[model samples]
Target: MPTDVTYPILNAQRATELLEIAKSYDNDTAFPAAELKEIGVLLSQVIGDDKFVGSAEDVAPTADLLNAFMLLLICQEPTSPAAAQSALHIASLGALAGNPAITSRGFRLASRYYDALQDSEKAWAYAKKAAQAGDDAQLIKLQNIAEQKRAAEEALAAQQAQAAEAEETAELEPEEPEERERTGTLEEQLNELRDRLEIAKRENVKEHSEEFVDINRQVQLAAFSEEDSLPASPVGVAPNPSTALAKALSILLESAVGALWACPSFATRSHVANKSNEILRKYHLSPEYATLPAGMLARFYADAAGNNTDTTGETAADFYGLAAKEYSRSGNEARELEMLLRKVEVFLIDNDRDEAHDILASRYVNALKYTELPIAARWTVLFSETLRTEAENMFKSTQVLMDFLGRHPIASARSPLDFNALAEVFELLGDRYTSANDAVTAREKYRVAYELFNTANNQEALAALAKKA
Candidate 1:
């Protein structure tokens, strides 16, 4: 039944004829190949089409005609992917024109198709839409199930809220849980990530809480004479009684002076510098009493005028290098990684995610093994920033990066990747293949993504991919 597509697709009579033939399929259960071609041509014509500016010469199919196609599709191949896809496109055309009939049938078709695939979440979505169109009993029943699921989800949310409140209020040790030592299989880790990625996307990871940022900012950085983060004393302090005593004295002085003098006063700059220098110099004279103190200050400026705004990003980049230095020097890997992550966070704020990623990808790849929930969460934030921001340019490499991250390795813990995040990754991969015209690979990715979460927006993409086979 394939027509000579050489018949000008833009010809008004051609569209009208195809619409008439499609609607009169009283005997057929499936559309003939020619009719499918006509339908496809219409879809192609409408892709990125300018909105209909109704005038005397408007040749496009009307809303009523689109609605008729929806009904025709439902009757012809209600459960087929192709028909559902066709219905989705045609129904959208009607909905744009505020046609109730087309909208109703479209939802009904979608609900039926998803239900056939045994995907309750998606089926429930369209069924709710169908019910909203009118008071259909079947639609109402399906809507009720969707409502019950929503209620259950809400209840789960409340429980999680309560648990979070408890955790926040609890007096807890800073160490990770004992179960963190157990790392599971790759499959298990992938499943964990799949679920996590879904939820993260649902909540929109782009807009997550900066709880770690606040924590890092508020943390008192360990001040050792060897720690380059703070202006250190010349003699490095070791784990000795005298060194410990010196560390204690330094902490006391920092709380009293260093913390207070975070913002250097112009009038007192020279005085404080002289005092600090003399204090450190005294350590050389009196070897027993080291004067290095606890540090909680960000000494950004070299002079009181604060002339260096770090406009070239060298200063930010140096912080990353110092963090690396601290990481190599400290035996406590967790603390050092946290300190490094804080620097990366600042890099992100400075709109330097590329630098942040480079530091993380190269210097801190080992941090991925960190089993602490808080630490894993930090990596998740970092990955989210880098992967999402660089997604368009580095999609292939982004996939490799995320894949290498594997799991958080915390026992019975959620994945580092949120469910939506993974779905998005796959979706993006699908797009990459599609752009390359690798239909087979693109369709496989699309199907997996669609199965993970059925989105109305991906309908045409899924359809287009399916048609290639």
Candidate 2:
């Protein structure tokens, strides 16, 4: 395996020239064969050396140069597999450097290469990555390209399937063949998007993950809606004044939080946070926007709690509680539970064991009673383990453990609990009993823990437990 090594930063003049070359040209623009080979050699030397220093500013120019070489290679030989591989390598470099611009450019090329290979899903995934790296325009272009490709493929399939019928109809009519319609008109497209968004909202789809990429795509597309026919709101949801205002607000809130993260001085962060809070407060009452601002405020307060000298965590708990309530109002039980867990974590960090225990236990019992086992089980395990480590009453910890075991038997294959984690829990229980000088219970727990460790194929843990025994 090749290891990365640090190199001296590139010269500023050379870096600028490389970026200019990379960004100025498109696939149609050709490079001289000699110039392409020269760039290829330069790229090979940089990559072959594997000297991608941690500084993105230093490595960015090189990444741009590599991507430029890829573009030139593609321009010259569109069929070359090497061009695709080169773009992929540049993307990896971009990830290592944490350069979004470079990553987006690399992903754009990779998307195009995969699209040309008829790998629609892979192409779409790359395009999605590009969009996330702040290249929304590229995502739209790629979507249109993929849609056109799908339409063409369907047209071809229809022609093949109806060849006989088409021949008979052609002989009967003897008319000119009409051009295939590419896409719907503006109004029809808006209606289609609105319908899809309504369906997604009705289904209560999880928008955070890629499980429903179309939701994100539709949201992003809606951001670009023209004023006259703004399909801004989903079905049964209150609309913003316009789609632009909603998009702008989202951007401003995100930018404000981002600036807070980058600010070194606590005073500056507080200033930014206060300003962000003002913006959030203005729209927080709006049903359409309430959930987001509440979550953002929770994040802000959580950060402040971590950095602030006061360790009480009182302020953070209040914000997280508000976030939980907002999530509940939005009917997002998962996020609400997550915020509750965050509250528990904040209290735990402050060493307020009683507060953490009460909050977590109260919520966990209620959730387990109402929520699905698969959903609640993980949270239950987390809460129990947290209490086991931090709670004052060891017996209560043991009871929670026994409760978990009774509900989700470890021996069962259908159980969602992790075997290694269960082994660790048992090991901790054995230690607690040993500390209490209960030889019989300690030995029994140790045996159970040893078995679980062995079952999990955890050789190190088994050795440690055997040594203790």
Best by lDDT: 2
**Residue 177 CA displacement from its true place in model 1, Å:** 44
Give lDDT tens digits, candidate 1, residues 324-373. 44344445466556656766664453467776777666644567565354
* C-alpha RMSD (angstroms) for model 2: 26.8
**Candidate 1, pairs of clashing residues:** 196-418, 196-419, 197-417, 197-418, 197-419, 197-420, 198-418, 198-419, 198-420, 250-293
Question: Which residue segments of model 2 deviate by more than 4 Å?
Answer: 1-247, 253-278, 281-323, 346-350, 367-395, 412-417, 451-469
Count clashing pairs, candidate 2.
0
For residues 63-177, what per-residue lDDT tens digits would candidate 2 score against the true structure? 6666667666666677688878777776777777667777787888888888777787878788778767855445556644645666689667865645654344445542222
What's the lDDT of the predicted structure labeled candidate 2? Answer: 0.58
lDDT of 2 at 367: 65
TM-score per model over all chains:
0.32, 0.35
Which 10 residues in a row give candidate 2 its minimum summed lDDT? 208-217
Off by over 4 Å in 1: 1-60, 63-324, 347-350, 387-406, 409-411, 414-469
The C-alpha RMSD of each candidate to the native structure, in angstroms, is: 20.5, 26.8
**lDDT of residue 133 for candidate 2:** 80
